[model samples]
Structures are given as C-alpha cells and as structure tokens.
Target: MTSAPGTYDAAAEAIAARLASGGAAARIAAASSLFARGDAIPHERRAVMDLACAYLRLHPGRDADGEPAFDADDESVRREILHQIRERFLASSGDRWDHQQIPLTLARTYLPDVDLSKVHIRSDRFLSGAWVAGDVELSHATIECGDAEHLATLDDDRPHFQLTGEEGDLHFEAERAAGSVSLFDQLRCHSIDGVGVTVRGGRVRVSGHIGAVRLPVLTATQGVSISGLVGCSFVGLLGSDLKGEVSIDLEPALSAVDISWSAVHGDVSIFGMALDHGAARVAIHLERLTVKALHLGGARVSTCDLAELEADQVTVRECDIDELRLDGALVDGGTIEYSRIGRLSVDDATLGPSWVRDDPPARVDWLGDESRETVIGLNIVGSTTEVPPQGLIDNDCVGTMGDLLLDGFPVPLRRDSGTARSGAK
Candidate 1:
C-alpha cells in the first residue's frame, strides 16, 4: 500500500513498529516486504532517512544509548535490511540527495554500483573496505565535516581541510571495477584513501582540495589527471601504473608529491606547482619513473630527484629549484632553458644533446666517479659558474663552438688518448 503525500511520519512509524515486533528472521522479512512494494516507499530523501534511522536503531553502537542490544545474527539481519533498502528502494531513484545528513555509518559494507553524482552530503561518509561492482561516479559530490563551527574558528592561513578523528573525514577506500571514477568539480572532502582500489579501466580524474590523498598502490588502466588542488599536504601515487598520460597541477603550495616507481605510457606534465617552504623539505620524487616525455615548468621546489628516470625527452622551463638531480637517468634529449637552479648533478647519466642555460650561474657537477667508455654530449651556454673539471670523464660539446660559450669564453674541448673530454661546455 502506498503512503499518501506528507505521510512520511506515518510510514516511519509503521516501519519502526514492524521491526520492533520481530526477531532477526521476522525483521528481515519485514524489510523485504517494506522495500518490495516500490509504491510503499516514500520520496528518495525521506525513504533514505527513515530507513537509515531504523537501521541504526537496530544496530546501535556504544554512542547510541537506550537502544535494544542485538546479537551477531541480528547484526547480519540489519545488514540485509540496509542492502535491500539501498538496492531496491534508493538505487533506482533519479533524485539527488542534496543537503541531507546521512546517519548511516557504512564501513565495511558491500555496495552495489550506484550513481552518487552531485550528492551534497552534510556529514561524514565512511566506506572503508567496501567492494563496488562497477563505476563510482562521484563528480560534483561533496562530503562536508559535521563540525563546521569549530573549523571556522581556526586560523585562515593554516590548513583547515586537514581533518582528524573518524567523525570529521570521508573515508572512501572502496575497491571498484573497470569503470571510470570521476572525482572532480569542486568535490570538497577532508581526506580520501584509495590504497586498496584498483581501477582496471577508464580515467581517474581527481581535482579540488581533498586533503592528504593517499592512492599509493592504485593501478589505473587508463591515465589519471589531478589538478587545481589548494592547501593539499600530500599526494602519494607510488608504485602506480597509469597506462596513459599523467598530468598534475597543484596551486599555491603542497608538502610533498611522490610518483616514484610508476610507469606512464604517455607524456607526464607537472606544471604550476609550488612546494610549501614552511613545511619540511621533500623532493618531487620521480625516481625509477619511466615516462614517454617529462615536462616541468613554473614549479618552485626545494629538490627534484630524477635518479634512474627513463624518459625520451626532458624539458625544464621557468622553474626555481634548489637541486635537480639527474644521476643514473637515461634520457634521450633534455633542455634546462630559462630556469634558476642551485645545483645540477648529472653523474653517471646517459643523456643526449642537453642545453643548460640557467640564471645566476648554476653549479654543474657532470663528472662521474670513474671515466666513461663513451663521451657525453653537453652544451652549456650563458653565465654559469663553478664548473670544476678535476674528475671529468669522456664529455664533449654538443652544438657548435659558438653555442658552447660559458662566461663569454669558448670552452676548451680537449682529447686525451683518443677520448673526447670537456668542461662546462
């Protein structure tokens, strides 16, 4: 039987009475009967709220006082009831549950493929250890902290989105299938954990300020793009295989960004990013990363560790970095034009024709511990200083003599025992 309009209270009272009169089996039967009749369920909003309240009432935790205690079998029955309500009553609804407080603590639950797009949840949503069958479309959805008044009293310069405690964050550690995960468009949340997730297909586009996102072991078949993040502390994508282009752009500042041991088939672009100087110093790690082309621009960081990087083309433009280590890198072509770096180390690297023209004279350390079998082609132009040649190996000038001028003097290209050796050219 369908409840009349504006009879949400009556429907909720009926559900409470029916569940109160039954044990585990009877309650499960009541849940099945209540959700089986689609017309008996109220609007999506009221139906979700009432059903969630009933579910919490049955499976009350330590905070829920004056509620009837249930055994393990009753707990299983409560999960079944929630599953029926989610799959049958709410999944088919096209309405967006906006500006509502979802009281269900959905941790460790098995969720079906559902569209929560544009849903504005005004509370914490915990989905840790949940397994999803298909795509998780969370584009334009927001999960706000329940304690807003306390957040407003904090300092503005500090990172307000860095939230702690279980009740103040959105825990989404669900494992999804080979469907696209869209987490962009002002999707504000305290933090997210996708470490246990593996996206077998579709692009994983993540934007907005989701504080301290940890997706270290995520394996996305398609590429991933993360941009427009503000006040983000950390972004961990270690040991991930993004089979397509990997693009990342962070605004203002961040603590650290690591993509070590990752492989990308397409070009990797990291621009418009600046590390926070107030926080501890952490390099933008690209160690052992294999990419098609690597581009770095408009970034101001303390250190950029590119040791053991395998890239076809490496380009650095308009950046202010303290140290740029290219040790053990296997790059085909590289250019450091129009940048200011404190120290540039290229020890034991097999790089093709590279041009180093940095402002304020960057220190170039291109000498390996021992002599190399083959000569390294390096073209250094502009006013770079402190180019010591005590431990120079087989190094030669890349371009013409005019293009290898350092301090307005042509660098001496000498030959020792039929092996070409040069200094700062």
Candidate 2:
C-alpha cells in the first residue's frame, strides 16, 4: 500500500510488533491497529479509524497537497485489510464498540467530534457493502445504489445495520431529491416529513412503521413509486406532474392531503384531500377516498364523491364509482356505470356526452343501491319542444320550410299529411 511520504516506518513497526506477539489478543489489536497513540488502545484509535475510513472512502481523488489521499487503488492491500477486518467483525456483528469523541477527515476538511451532520454518498463513492451503526440524518440528500440488480446486493438483514440517535430523535426525510436511494429491507426512522417531495427516479419500499407519510411531487421527466404504510396525518403534493403509480396503505383515516398533477394513477386511501386549483390537475384512474369532506380550489378530476365536494370545474371519466359519487358533477365526456354507483347526488353539474347512452334496461340501472332514490330532474326555459314520459325535450327544427316544430321530440313522432302541407315539412 502507498503511504504518505516518510510515513511508512511507523505502520511497518506497528504491524511487526503485533506479529511478534502472535495470539488472539494480538490478532484483535492488529485488525484495528494504527500508527498513532494517545492515552489508551481503543480510545485514540477511534480518530484514526474515522480518518482512515473517510480517507479510504474518498480515495483515488487527490488531496490538497496533490498526493494520493488513500490507497484504495491498491486492490491487493485494500482487499487484504478488508478481508481481515470482516472476518473479525462479522463473527460478532452485533457487538457494539463505544467510540468516544473522534475526528473525521473528509477530503481536506477535518471535522472534529462530528454530530448531527448529514453525509451524502454519491454514485461514485457508494461502496458495494457499507455499514453504519450511529444515527444518520439524511434530509433531501441523494444516496444512490444504482440499478435494482446492483441495489439488491446490500445486506440490510445484518445485525450491524442499525442507525439510531444518541437522544432518540433521528429523522430521515427525502423530500424533493433528484437521484435514488434503495433500502433493500426495513429502514427504521423515528420520523419522516415528505411535504411536496419530488421523487425524480427509483422506487422506495419500506416494511417498517413510519411516523408520517406524504405524497411525492412528480414531473414529466421523472417517476416515483412507494409500497408502504404511513401513520402521519399531514401530507402535501404540490407543483409535481405525477406520471407513475403512488400506492399507499394508511390507517383507514387521514387528516390532510394536497394534490396537483395530471399524471396520477393507482390506488390511494385517504380521509380527505385539499386539492389545488391553480396547478393541481389529476386524471384519477383508480382511487378510494373516504373523509369528512373534500375541498378543491383549482383542479380537475376524472371521478370523485359528490357530497362535501366543491370545485370550479372537476372532471369525472369512465371508472367504477361508489358511495357519495359525483358522476355528473364535472366532466366533458366519460362513461358512467350506474350499477356500481352508490348514494350519488349532483348540483350545477355539466353532464358528459358519454353518460347519456341508450340501455335496454333503465340507464339509471347502473346507479348503485345507495342512489336508487336519486331523481334526475331538469328544467329548460325559452324553448318549444316535444316531451317524453321522463322529461321534456326542446325540438325546433328549421329547414327550407323556415320553422318546423315537432310535437314529440324525445318520444316517437308520426308524419302528418296536413302538417306537411302547412310548410312544417
């Protein structure tokens, strides 16, 4: 291994001294041996380990003095040292080492007694097998592990993969980051706050309990996905153009939700959602929302509930609908399966052309059991037209005859010879 100028003798002497002792204690001491000494064995070496690990992690990059900072390029030495250390530590992986105040040398900066600071592991610096025990605060930092195949190599089941704070208040919030972070198994964080978080790439799956959950903001250029259960109440998704699926399982009730995008898909179970009108636009492919109320400021939806729903203009497309449905509330054109509907009601709604289809049974047959009592009422003014058994239809046909009015427009009409000769043909 390459050493920093004139520093070879001390390392060589240390290794030689351990070899001469030749025993289990000597082996243990040798595995963590360093060239410097300060009061005791393990206490002083903590600083050396921190510096060496940080230096090794940032190897290949030149130091401020233009010298090779670490010997990572030397595969033989790195492999030998790593193998020895792994063999020693892996045997008793759960063993905890109480490391006191230590200094970390990152690049050229020497951080003394680092605490509560965040570290970012970029794509190039991410080693294949990395381990940590202490709490790590990662809020909006990018930690990439590359593709799914390469990402699966992480051994999260190992007993040493713990990360907890000294005071028991650690948090991991990845809100609005551009890269990817793959936690193969369970990642336990005390609290997570993802408000308007933009996830541009990768998939996140957690099998553990989380303090809170929030919707991710997506763009046309990126995609995000999550499969987990969230326990928090406050969540926001603003200024994001979602194009992928966002699947979430919550505790049957939610407090707040904000959505603004058009490319949202999949299933979401929430108590309520506060939709944005200025920029919020989503074509709901499949959604199940049950809350006390819903407020939409500036937005459009493919389908939603009718009760406690208020918006400037909302859109409801073709999808299986249910209780408190807003089928005719706001939509340009879409199919409505009334058989699947339940407890539906509408006021000042714009009917979709696709909803007025001819059916052998009553078109209202599709309205679910809850809405069986709902009546479709209409009142039109300033028009003359024929009427049907259900309602009146305005029919004013003008041809070369100028004005020809039909007696029955919505109902069947019969041609009259007398009326034909009266310029009503």
Candidate 3:
C-alpha cells in the first residue's frame, strides 16, 4: 500500500509498518496512525484495538495473574495510554494520567475512542463525531479552544451515559472562548464535586438528563442555554448575561435546587428550586421548590412565581425592586421576609408564620393564612398594614361577616373598614 507521501494508501502502509516495528518508535507511529485514521477506522475496529493495546500495556507480561515479566518503567507509555483510555472513554479513578497531551493545531478530523483523562491538552482539541466511554474523569483538566461554530458532538446512542471524575472531583475545564461544546444525551456525576463546568463567552447546548452537577462558581456568559432536567445540588450561578431568557425545566414537586451565590442579568425560571442557600439576580421562578434560605441581593424579580412549593423556610434578605407573586404555595414552617418591595402580590398561597420587614407600607390580600384575620389586610408585627375598602376579613361580630385579623388580632370583615373604624358612614 506504499504510494505517494500525501496519499491515503501511503499513510495506511506507514501506520502498519510502525505497528509491526514493536518499540517506542513503533508505538508512537501507531498512535500517529490512529490519530490520522480517526475518522477512517470503523468504530468496531477502533474499540477492539484500544482494548488490546490497553491490556498489553497495563498487564505487562502477566497472564491474568499477579506475575510480572516486563518492568513498569519499561512500559510506562503503554500504561499511560491505558489510563488515557479510562479517563477519556471510561470512568475516572483517583489515579490520574497527567502527562498525556493532545495537539491543538491538528486538522479538523474525527477522533473515535479518544482518551484525554487527566491529560493536559496544551492546545484546543477539536473533533467531530467523537465517541466517548462512560465514567470518564476529567477532574482539574483544562481545555481552551478556537472560535464559535467549532462543534464536538458526543455519542448519544448508548444508555447510562455520563461524564464524571472521581467522587468530589471535576471532569474538564473546557474553555471555548468562541467555540461550542455540545454534550448530548444523559450526563451523570457525583455530588459535592465538579467544581467548575464553565461555558464562558460561547454557546453550550446540552439536551440530556444532567444529574449531580456541582459547580461552586458557575458562569455562563454571552450565550449558554441548558435544556432538560438539571438535577444539580449546591450551585452558584453568577453574571448570566443572557441576551435571551434562561429557562430550566426540572422535576416537579420539591426538587432540591440550592444556589449558594448566583446572579443572572437575564430572566431565570426553574421548574423547581429547593433552595438551601443561594443568591440570585433578576427574577427567581420555581414550580415545586422547597426553599430553606434565599437571598435576592439587589436582584430584580418582575414576578417571583411559586407553584406547588413546599418550603419550610424562605428568607428574601436585602431587597428586591420588582413585583413578587406567590401562587399555589404550601409553606410548612418558614417566613417570606422582604426588606422593601415595589409591588407584592400573594394569591392562593399558604404561608407558615412569616415576618415582613418594617421598611415600607405595602398592600397584601390573598387566600390561606395562619395569621390574624383582617378585612383589608393583616398587620404583621413591626410592619404597617394597608386595608382596602372592599377587602375581606373575619370578625366575631358577624358569624362569617367579620373583618380580617390585623397583627394577630380579630378585626371586622367590612367593605368600609376605614369609615367603620373612624365611626363614619
């Protein structure tokens, strides 16, 4: 098959010759052949070769026994390749492969079964139709690449798909300043790990089931859209300068969504946010969330909608200069403490005893309350209460015709409360 220098046949012959040499030089030649024939070789052939090479390199003169023939030092590169396979295609173990590397200026090619576990890629590694094995670990690995439109489509044909490192470990620090990294299908990981999975100044579209994603500091600048179920816990989103809306469709009914410190300039709507502790920007919308502690520090919520929520406690510290809407909520034991609000509306919501800040005099009238009954509005302790003329209240004077409670005290339920209290009309 030896032909011209630039011919495909010539390149295949060169690869076969190198594999036959059986030495470091030969191994390097073989590696070069695999890289060159990334797209040329079929998936089945590549998989089989990868497995054989790893066994030979790692097992090292031992035939399925604890016997050693070749020295580990003599076969280090081969061992490294096996590690790369594990990290690149298989699961990541604590033992990392740190010396391997991938060139950046390489042509846009196809890299099947490409392993980069614990490997520090000095250049931007871009490949199309890349088939990755599950349980791959890229903890503390950095990948910086070229501009937008450069795509890397991972395999989505298999089930139980995931990209994760060891427990409490990161997978990859892929930085495509302008390019894109599309992770399709199901991606699973361990909790309290995956510190930073950033997609900065680019577009990252992931259509799959993401579980146990932990990024203490997560930033999606420029354009980053994450669709599908994001079952992540203990996260912090900062500076999400999305030109469009950021939508998240999570599991219904109290799905835990805890953001330590997150700020989104664009609108954020989560299907359910069981917030343990976090800060957010703009607006926070939850479907069935259980918020333990929440702080919207100087964030703007045009409408804070809560649906099927079962929050034991929710505290909106600081202040939010926006409209607050709470609907169909079932809070067991918590408080909705607001420092100051532009407009607040609570409709068909159940609140466990709460304390409103004594900052502004606002209006609140809705259903389901465990506080004092009032005609127009209930007067919270240390806060002023406003009573509209036609507001409902429960009183002892009339059976079902009493005023709403003000400050846990029974008040008359009358349409003309101001006039009645003033003894007019």
Q: Which prediction has the highest TM-score against the true structure?
A: 1
TM-score per candidate, chains pooled: 0.49, 0.35, 0.36
Better of 1 and 2 by lDDT: 1
TM-score, predicted candidate 2 vs. hidden true structure: 0.35
lDDT of 2 at 175: 15
Of the two candidates 1 and 3, the one with more favorable TM-score, higher being better, is: 1
Q: Which candidate is the best by lDDT?
A: 1
Candidate-wise lDDT, in order: 0.51, 0.30, 0.35
Regions more than 4 Å wrong, model 1: 1-181, 273-282, 354-425
Q: Can you write out model 2's per-residue Cα lDDT over 1-425, one digit (the tens) per residue?
A: 43432122354345534422344455345444542332234443433333234323323335688833333223333333333323222213343222112211122211111122122222211221222112223233333324433333321221111123322322211111113443312323333433333323444333333443343433322233333433434334444454544333323223334453333433233221222223222332222222222222222232444422222323222222233344223433333221222233333334333333222233343224523332221122212222212221212211111121223221221222222221121
- Once model 1 is optimally superposed onto the true structure by TM-score, how far is the C-alpha of residue 136 displaced, in angstroms? 13
